[model samples]
Target: MSRTETAARVPTLATVLDVIRERVTVSRVELAEATGLTAATITHAIRELIDVGFVHEVGTAASSGGTPRRLLELEPTACYTVGIQLDRFTATGVVVDLAGHIVARSSMAGAQEGEPAEVLRFVADHVNDLLATAAVPKSKVLGVGLATYGPQDRTAGVLLTAQPTASWLEYPLTETLSEALGVPVLIENDATAAAIGEEGLGGARSSFATVYMAGGIGAGVVLGGQPYRGATSNGVELGHISIDAFGPACSCGNRGCVENIAGPTAVVLKANTIPGLADRLRLRGDTVADFERIARAATSGDPDALSILEESAAVLGTATVSLVNLFDVARVVIAGAAFATAGPLYRDAAQAAVDRAAFMRFAHPVVVELSDHVSDAAAIGGAVAVLRRSFEARTARSGAPAGR
Candidate 1:
C-alpha cells in the first residue's frame, strides 16, 4: 500500500498515543499539531485514552495569553507487557509498562541444544519468574513478544531456520508460547524489535536505523515513522551481507559474509588462534562470553585482543557504510549484547566510517551512537512490540486513519 493509504488506516487514537509517548508530555493543541488531527478529534481521543486510564493530565503548559493548555502523559502502570529475546546462547526477559520503562528483568540459559517443547517450557518458566519478580499479575499484561533470529513466517508464527537445531523449523512458536504463558504471544525479528523498542523509549528520531548485535549481526530501518520490513519482514540481514566474495563460505550459503568475518563467533575464533590468548583470557566455548572477554581485553589495552577487535570493528564499519548508503538514515544506533563491552570502539569506527565515506555526509552529518540499554534492547523491544500490536489491533477495530 502507499504511505498515504497506510497512514489513513491507522487509528487516530494509536497515532495520538504514539505522539504523546514520543513527546513525553504534550498538550491537546500540540497533539493535534503533531498528528495533524482536528482539534475536536484530538480532544475526543484524549478523553477516551484518559477514560481508559492509559493517559492522564499532568498539569497545564504555559499559555501565551489565553487559557492554559492541559499537559498529558502516559499512565505507565495502566498496563504491562512481557518481552523475551531468545537466542541460541541467552534468553533475556523483561516486563515493561505502558511508558516503555522496564520494571523487572531476568536472564538465563538460551534454547541451545534443547527440544522444542523443552525450550518452550524453559521460556515459560523464565517469563513466570519475571512477572512474579515484578509483582505484576498475569491479568494486567497485554501479552508477550518474542524476539529471535529469523527467516521465518511471522504470520504463521513459526521459525523457518534451523540454526540452533533442526527441530525448531516450523515449530508453532507463538501458539505454544501463548498456551504456556496463558496470554497472547507475538514473534518479531530481534533487530526489528530493537528498533521498535528504541522508538518507544522516546528519544529517537522518527527515522533511523538500529544495528543490533547479539549472537549475530542484523539491522532494522525505520523510515518516516514506520519500520521498513521488506517483502518477508526479514529485511536488513546485515550479517549475511558479503564483504568479501572470495574469503570464506557462510552458513547462509553465501561467501565472505560480514558475520562470518567479524561477528562474535568470528572474533573469538580469531582470538583463539593467538596461542594462549584464549587461555590467558579464560575463554570458554560460549561465543557470547568469549567475545565479551576479548572485548574487555581490548578495552584493557591487550595488544592481541585490541588487534582482533579493531579488525572486527573495521569490517563492521564497512558494513555500516553500506547500511547508511542503502537506508540514508541520518542516525544509526549500535545496540545489543555484543556491543556491551566494546561499544565505544564500534561506535567510533562506525562514526568515523560514516564521516569519511557516507554518501550524505557532505549534505547531512550521520550520527552513530550506542544504546543505553545495549544488552537488553531486543528484550525491551519485544515488550514494546506487544504494545504496538495492541495499538494496531485497536486501529483495526476502529477503522480510522492514524493521521500522523
Candidate 2:
C-alpha cells in the first residue's frame, strides 16, 4: 500500500493507542512527548481510545508541585490476536493481547505429507479450537497472523516454494484463513515474524537480528526500531546462504547451504552415521523428536550427541559471523524450533565465534543469546503482527520506538 493509504488506515487515534500499548502505562504528557504529538492531540486520541474501551485512566502519577497527572494504560483484555507458526513438523499457535502476553498456546503435528488444502483446513480448525478452548470471546478477537517459512509473497499472503510445504506453492493463505475465520488474516515469513516477536516481548531494546533455526534456517533483521522487510518481505534467506561450494544441495537451489549443514536434519543424518548413536536413541523419523532426544543426550554428557551439537553450532556461528559483518548489528538472537531443544549449545558457539572474530569486535562487541521463546518465537510474532502496524506509525512520528 502507498503512504497515503497507510496514513488513511492509521489515524492519530490509532497511533496514540499504539503509544499507550508500548508504554504499558504513561501520563498524557509522556504520551505526547513519546508520540511527538501535541497535548491536545494526545487528549483527543485518548478520549477516543477510552470511549472504545481500548485505553483507560489507570491512576495519577506523583506530581512535582503541580496537579497530579492522570496516567493512561491499555485495557489489555479488550481484544486478542491469534499467532500461528506452521513448521514442517509441527504447528504452533498462541493468543496474544495488546500488551504482548501469551494468553494461550497450542501445538500439533504439522504432517508435512498432507495435502495443502487439507493441512490448511486443519490449521483453521485448530485456530478455532484454540480460541474456544481458551474461552476468548469471539467479539474480542481482532485477527489471525501466520508465520510460515519463505520464500513467500507476503504482499499477497501467498506461499511460494519453501521448506514447510511443497504442496502449498502459490497457495493463497491469508484469503483462505480469513474466509475460514471471518476476520482479517496476515501472513509473514517465520524468520521476520520471530524477529518482531523478540523485539516486542523479549528483552531487546530495539535494534537487533534474530537467527531462526527450525524446519529450515532463516533470519529476521530489525534496524532503526523497525523490521527491515526486504522487497515483498521475502528479503532474508539466512538458511539458504551457501557455506560450502561443493556441499550438499538445498531446496532453494543452493550448494552447501547452512540448512544442509547445520540444521536438525543434518544433525540427525550425521548422528545416524555415529557409532550406535541412532540405534541407542531409538531414532525415529520425526525430526523434532530426534532433536530433543539428541539434545538431551548431549546435555547428559554423551560425547557423540555433544559432537553433533558442536558441529551444528560451529557452522551456525560461521554464518552468524557473516551476518554481523554485513549488518553491523550489536546484538543477535538465536530463535525458532531448532533452537528450542539445543539453544544453549548454539548460543555458546555463535557467541564465541562472534566475540573472537567478528569484524567489529574492536569497535563494538556483539551479544549472542537464546530467544525468550525458542520454538514459539514465530507463533508469538504472528500474534503481535496484528498490533505492530500501529506501533510502526508511532515510530514513524516520533523517530524512535514508542516506548524507547
Candidate 3:
C-alpha cells in the first residue's frame, strides 16, 4: 500500500498491532476477540502489517474441532526506537526493537546545571552513539522517547517546572531534540513511562501501580489496560503526597511531603546525622550515589544503615497505604535506580503496610513486587512510548472511530 493509504489506516493497524505484540503470538480469531474488532477488520490489518514487514505468520495453533488457525507474531527487526531517561544526576539511553527488547544501552552525566541547548546536544550525541553501538541504521528508527520528571505541558513538548534550574522551564525540548537527532521526539513523565514499560512486559494482571524512585519518588497507575494519565498527564504525584502536616516544609510548597520525609535525599540526610556514618559508608554528596551506598551497607547487614533504611521504608510504606486506598489496585510495582539494591526492603515494607492497613484488605490482598527492569525501566518505557505512538495512534486524523 502507498504511504497515504497506510497513514489512513494507522489507527486500525496500530490497534491490531498492539494486541499482537501484547499477546506475543495470536491467531486472527483471538485478535478479533481481544480487540473487539470484526474478523474482516482483523484480516485487513494483519494483511497490511504483513505486507509492511512488521509481522509474519509464526505457525498454526490447534483448533477446537476445526481447521488449525495460523498464528502471527511481531517481526522484531522490522524497526527500532530509542528511549532516554533524563534525570538531574544521570541519564540512560537504550535502543529497543519492536519486541521491546533492549539491543544496546548507554549511560552518562545528566543535565546537571547544563543549559537546554547543551543538554539536548549531549542527548542527541548519546542517541547517535547508541544507534551506532546497536548497528541499527537511523532510517530504521521510528523515533525517540524521552522520560523525565514533570509538572509540565506534554502538548507543548516543554517542561513547565524550573526544576534543576529556571532555564529548563518551558524549554522547547522536543523540537530541539528532534532537530538535532533528525527524528520525531516525544516526552513522557518518568514514573508514567516506567509503568507503561512494566505493563508492556506482559503480566497476569492488567491493572497495577508503579512506584518509581531515582533522584526522587513518584508513581504511575494503569487501569483496565490503559494508563490513567489524568488531565494534563501529571496525575500520580506520589512524591508530593503529604505524610505529615506539621513536619519540615517541601520545595513544592507542601508541608512534610512523603518524598521530603522519606525519599532518597531524606534518607541520606538522616544518615548524615550519625557521626562518622558518612565516612563509614563513603557517602558521596550526590543523593543517588549516597542512597545507593546506604542501601549497599544495609544489604551487608550494617545495623545503622539497616535502621536508617528501615525508617525510611516505614514512612514510604505509610504513603503507599494511601496509594492503595485511593487506587484500589491489586498490585504495586517498585522500580527505579534507587531500588537496585534495597528493593526487597521497600517491597516488604509496602506489602506489610498494605496487608495491615489497606482499606480493601478485607476484600483482597495487595501484592507488592519489584520491577525486573530496575534502573532502566523508564528508558525502556520511553522507547515503548515511541513505538506506541507510531503503531497505536489512538485517534485517527480522518475522524474515523479508532479500533479498540
Candidate 4:
C-alpha cells in the first residue's frame, strides 16, 4: 500500500483489541458492532491478535440466529507485569497478569521511613522474591509499575522534593529500578495508583471521579476517566492543603495541614495520651494493626478511644469537605492501614461534612465507601498500573483505568 493510503487508513486494530481485552470475551460480530468496522475488518484484526498470542478463541457463544458464534478472549497469561508500592516504613511487590489479576505478592519491612536507598532495596528484594515464587517467564513480563508518596517529576521519573526519607531528594526511581529489574518502569504517586486501581477494578469502575483517602490525607482526581496528574506529580496533596493555618505545626512545615491534624501518626499521638484508652485498645504493637485495634475499640464504644478517634475524624472530615467542594467527585474510597482501625467512623464523619458543606450539595449525593482491599489495593493498583500502561502505550488511546 502507498504511504498516503496507509496514512488514510484508520488503525482500529488496537482499539478493537483493547475493548476485547477489557471486556474479557466478545464475539466477532460484537467487535464489529463496537468498533463500527465491517465484519471483514473485525475478522482481520482478530486474526492478527490471535497470531500474536494476544487473543484466543475461548469457546462458542450461544446461538442468536442460524449458527453459534465463537467467543474471543484476551490471553491474560500471555503477559505479566510487576507492581511495587513504597511507603514510609515498608514496600510491597506484586505480580499480575494481562487482565490485572494478581499472581504473586511479596513484602518486606525496612526503614522506608528513613531513606530512599533503604526503601528501594526493600522493594527490589520483594520483587525478586515475588518473581521467584511465581516463576514468571521473563519474556512474557511487560514491566514494572511503582507507586510512591511523592512530590514527583513524572516525566523525569524522579522525586523532586527532599523528604523526611533519607536520599529521597531528586531520586532517580525509575532508572534505578529499571536497571535493577531490567524492565521498563512507570512511576506514579500512591494516590494516583489507588485512584487508577479503583478506576480499573474497584467501585469507581463506572464513575468518572473518585477520591482515594489513605496513609496521609489526599484525594486522587480522575476527570473523564483520566487521572489529572498536574504539571507536577504533586497534584492533590490534600495532606499539605491547609484548612487551619494556625492550628498545629505539620511536618510538611505548614501549620494545621490535614496530615498534622488527622494522619496516622497524629491520631496515634493524640490517642495514646488519652486516659485509660491505651490499655483497652492495646495500641502498643509495632504495626499499624495495633492502631487499627484501637480504632475498632473506639467504634465499639470505648469512651476514651472514641474521643480520640472522633477528634481525628473531625479533622479528616473537614479536609474531605474541602476536597469535595473543589472536585465535586462522584465517589470517595477511604483506604490505608489507618482507616482499617476506624473506617466506619471516618466514613460517616466525612460524608456528614460533605453533605453539610460541599458546594454542590444539591446536585447529587457523593458516594462515600471504604476500600475493602486495604493495603492490598496499592499493591494491586501497582500491577494494574503496568497493565494500563502496556495497553494504552501500545493502543495509543488513553483510557482511564478504574481502581483495582
TM-scores for all candidates: the values are 0.94, 0.89, 0.91, 0.83
lDDT of 2 by residue, 1-404 (tens): 45544443343555566667677889989987886777776776676567657788878998788799998888888888999998777679998876667888888777477777777789989988898887887789888888988778877888777444466788888898889888778888899989888876744645888999877789999885567786778887888889899999776778999989998889999999988899898899788889888998998899999989999999999999999888899999989887776899899999999998899999998999888799899998888777665434543564421221
Q: List per-prediction Cα lDDT, in the order shown.
A: 0.87, 0.81, 0.86, 0.70
For residue 385, what is the lDDT in candidate 4? 72
Model 4 Cα shift for residue 351 (angstroms): 2.2
Candidate 3 residue pairs in backbone clash: none
Index of the highest-TM-score prediction:
1
- Model 4, 287-395: lDDT tens digits are 4555677677787887777777788788888788777777777677776546655778888988888888878888988777887665666666677777656654543
Q: What is the lDDT of residue 337 in candidate 2?
A: 80
Better of 2 and 3 by TM-score: 3
* Candidate 3 vs. true structure, TM-score: 0.91
Q: Please give the distance, in angstroms, between residue 20's alpha carbon in candidate 1 and its true position after superposition.
A: 3.3
- Candidate 4 overall lDDT versus native: 0.70
- Candidate 1: residue pairs that collide: 8-401, 10-401, 10-402
lDDT of 1 by residue, 1-404 (tens): 44454355444665777788778999999998887888877886787688779999999987789999999999988999999998887678999988777899877787778878899998998899989999999999999999999887989998998868888999999999999989999999999988887876754657999988988899988886677889989999999999999989988999999999999899999998999898999998998889999999999999999999999999999999999999889999998888999999999999999999999899899999898889898998888778777766665565544343
Global Cα lDDT for candidate 1 = 0.87
Top candidate by lDDT = 1
Superposed Cα deviation of residue 335, candidate 4 (Å): 2.3
Name the weakest run of 10 consecutive residues (lDDT summed) in model 2.
395-404
Off by over 4 Å in 3: 1-24, 32-38, 58-68, 392-404
